[model samples]
Target chain A: MALGLALALLALVLALVLAVAWRGTGLALGPADWAAVRFSLVQAGLSALVSTVLAIPVARALARRRFPGRGALITLMGAPFLLPAVVAVLGLLAIFGRSGLLNRGLEALGLPTVSIYGLHGVVLAHVFLNLPLAVRMILQGWLAIPSERLRLAGSLGFGPSEVFRHLEAPMLREVLPGALVVIMVVCLTSFAVVLTLGGGPAATTIELAIYQAVRFDFDLGRAAGLAGVQLAIGGVAALAAWGLYRPTGFGAGLDRRLEVAAPAGWRLWGDGLVLGAVTLFLTLPLLAVLLRGLPGLAELPAQVLPAALRSVLVALVSTVIATALALTLALESARRPRGLIEAAVTLPLATSGLVLGTGLFLLVQPLATPMVLALPVTVLVNTALSLPYLYRVLLPETRALQADYGRLAESLSLSGWSRLRWLVLPRLARPLGFGAGLAAALSMGDLGVIALFAGEGQATLPLVVGQLAGAYRMEAAAAAALLLVTLSFALFWAFDAGGRRAAA
Target chain B: MLQLDHLTHAQGDFRLTADWSANPGDRIAVIGPSGAGKSTLLAVIAGFLAPTGGAVRWKGHDLGPVAPGQRPVTILFQDQNLFPHLTVAQNLGLGLRPDLRLSPAEQARVEEALARVGLAGLGQRKPAQLSGGQAGRAALARALLRARPVLLLDEPFAALGPALRAEMLALVREVADQTGALVLMVTHDPEDARALGGETVFVGDGRANPPVETGTLLANPPQALQDYLGRK
Candidate 1:
């Protein structure tokens, strides 16, 4: 009942805003809105299509082959999922920006300079973030194909091409649509990436436009109207994607122990080269951030420490809140099987943090003092924003647990507090810990809520980095960026370790 | 004492109607075909399901208004008997008290229970560290700690080998004897009924029968029991 009320309140607010903005703004759908809408769709479509397509061979190789550093490589595939958008953008800038490492190297070699702005930079950042995600998802798909089928194909003297034609292709066709939809939804709300790398008119996304309308123009009517448009587009996209989506695999009892054999000598070398080049491309910018920031570490003690402390405090509170909400929702959903609540939990994924931040600001600023409520409001927004990720991490485990343990506990009269303590909490400790770590790391690197609420003395690390960049404090920003990256990673690692210990 | 009067439950395509009763010390084994809803009957009795039309009474009081955990009953499931994250001692402790804050003597009781289950020194081990038979014993031990008047087993030892299954069945009988609890177990195996020597209740065709002598039922069974056992 409480969950339903919370969702109802959110929906009512959105509906009220839509009704008022529609009446007062007189904001008819216009050409500019249409252009922004078209650009958003095109960018998301191209990004998803490209990332999934490129991930196929890589995922196949990774799933089938085992070599040295396999654990590290697989772990690296999960890195981008945890990496903050703003931190990733900074790293990309350190490698691709005008005075960046690559451009400087090109200048030293007397070669032509490459521009890192506009569509190319946006696409680059998208690919950097989405590529690993796509690879992991697709690899999970490939790993799911029962090995007995492959062994039968091998026994029947089917060649590699024949096997792929019959088995792998069909599997990919089944998995691709869902993966594409997921990636498309993620890209549709692309905010920090576009804000940082999207140069001008040519690269602006609808999300960036909405942010501009609210922050720069202070046109509440226009912002509210744009918000309506944004939600409409998101709703339509989600509906279309829902039409195309299909469940990929059950993903239970997958052959985690299966190892792909290396190909013969030259073939192995070629595979290695492709893997190395892709990894280098993905990792170079992170390297640049580290290299550049190392020299500025002495200067970091002044501002970075305070910002780091604030980030830690915010991350801890938000992560705990997100975890609690996610666990409650997961448990409730398990008990009652509410599809609408699950969908509501995921709605934030399709909506950008900027849009949510704007809504929260508008809704709360009228009721409370912005200065006093800033920190809590920031934490609240961050927790709500992270609810989807935490829910995703916790839901699968919760469902599996209910399937396995529900009857036993119930028959034993384990429900309510007793059920949670004896069965649910204990079984879910691992996933809960993991989800909390992810929430913490994500909250730590968040710049969206902080961007809107933070004043001079109230900045988080990512916001501090953004401010430093705006002030042309390149070295200091780089140092702060490095610190942010380390902090986020450390937070995740520590929480994950704690989760493991709890499980142990 | 427990009673189920015209208990009927529908789960998706599966439906069950049970009319039965057991006295304080009666042990009933519900045997049925795979989809015959034996577990569903137990679930309805356990308060895990709201029957479409029926009444469950315990000790002359209607159980319709009581929640599952609050009932004077404990059940051991087929698998996932213990919480994976908790040590065996902690799992035992949870059955004694949900908050799991125990006094020294209360903690000693948990230790004694573990020792009774042959897991005294293994209390620190998580469920993953325990073997299948050990896990089953641990679950039984936890149920015993609950001190409930009714015990339910949902094919709890079906996964164990013949020897281990027999051992666990013996342990269950011993616990029930000591506690003077009514035991309701669901099983497909005639050997299980024979080994436990409980009253057999044949469940089939969307309904359950009253308890009959296990030895007589197995030796000179009705057509439904014959068919059910023949298939198995």
Candidate 2:
């Protein structure tokens, strides 16, 4: 039944979105809309290229070299990927905004003040956000090399170039396409980053265009058309990612520091330089956000607290819904390996927040005001978006559990609620908790659907940050971004720690 | 009586056919080679898999509609006999009530089964905390608590040492005696079948031959049985 509901929900949303887009203005793409499409593709392509290329040396350094903070640095690499996009944008702006540290330093050195807006700014923020993910993916490839293979290379007196040729280059070839495609799909549908730094006709992305069409112009037809284009790009990218992506077994052996060929002299300094520069680039903006937000924390605007409360509420509700739905889909699929449920769970990956929000807006406008339903709509969209991740996390564990214990539970007369409470829940607690934490954090940090539906008073924290930053209230924006990041991480840490304790 | 009435199970290309019945409290050993559908036969009886062509019956009633847990049977696999996350007592308690909502009387029964299985006062330990033999005892203890009319063993003690395996087989006999369960134990070892002391059912060549006396079958073995024993 839950599997039925999951498939039905995805089908219904896609049908409605497509129906509205198809029914509106005969699906015309204006010249400016075409421009938005071009900008979206170009920026995503550049971001994927730059992030993947830059991540190679850094992943190599981390994979081979051991230093005092090497373990800590690898752990920190996971932080930015989970860091809310709005918060990361605030951090980036704190360092690279017009009056930020970079501009001030350039003034001191008599160089021209550079603008952190348009194509370059969007790409920079994306690289900062996705660079860690790219590095981790590639590092998994490096670490996955068999110890026997590495030993053979060493015994054969392989040089660095030879090692790269025989070993590293092949691993990269197998891993790089996956990393590049995943990053491209991520950036293609990214709304918060582009909305913050990307503006004007030349820089607008499809998502931002959808938001503008809905909010400023009240042009539902145009929003629907843009959503169609967004869907096409996302569909193709998601398919490519699905085809190319390999698990890399990144979950295990990340901490097993391999003794690879870390040569001395120039190579040693070169690895150190790569590690240092990457660390500073990733950490400086975060530090600036902290340094700027501290004073404003004492005198946060009164509305920030309510907004925070609203965001937490949304996160909690959506986390529960996504976790429950994913559990249902996973268990049913594990019991009977059906393609329908798998397709339902994964289909949401090809649908964006703006597309769902716009279609839902068209559906809800005839019945009631979309503003009044903002938080609920946000909850629904967040649940749909995060369902795929939680499903992926739980499916393998659920399969293993069923394979091992399904018969035992069955022969013991454990069925229905009792089976779930006694057998499934305890067995699956770790993955359940971890997946829930991720869902909660993602929902809490989401600025997508709410941007389209929120009236003046119904703003979420990410929306509030965007508002503050847009008004040039950098200090207050920093403060809200700080609050948002703290709450998101806190929610994640609490759930994750709870899971570990339970499993222990 | 338990019946495998014209039971034929097919999965893809593999098939197993059996047409036999056993009296209540009868002991039978299902001995066969690897990939001979020994486990699949046990699975069909335990209601984990449906027969492709016929029905399973208990005491003249068709068990086709019964769910695995509701069937009048208990099956112990070779390993993972106990859930590792559950304590020994909770694992036993699940046999009494799926919800683990034990009344005071039922809770005492759980403790009694633990003591009966030589796991006395160790009911609080999780499966991980138990040794391999102790884990086998815990699973047997749960079977005792369940006290179903039919018991099926799929080499449940194969992981134990020789001495421990012998001891577990004795315990299985005791548990079967106490509950009056018709026992069907699947084993590859002739010594195990001999120790089990039952009518032997040879499952091979796409069929499960009905029971012959274990001692007689071993003494005047058929050609296929001779080949299997000789190869080993």
Find the candidate with the highest lDDT and give its number.
2
In Å, candidate 1's interface RMSD is 2.6
Write the residue-wise lDDT of candidate 2 on A85-199 in tens digits. Answer: 9999999998899998999999999999999999999999999999999999999888889988998898899989999999999999999999999999999999999999998
Estimate, for each residue in B126-152, the C-alpha lDDT of model 2 and write its tens digit: 999999999989988998999999999
- Candidate 1, position A165, lDDT: 95
C-alpha root-mean-square deviation, each candidate? 3.5, 1.5
List the TM values for chain B, per candidate. Answer: 0.96, 0.98
lDDT of 2 at A156: 91
TM-score of chain B of 1: 0.96
DockQ of each: 0.51, 0.82
lDDT of 1 by residue, B154-224 (tens): 99899888999899999999888877889989999888988777799889988888899899888888888
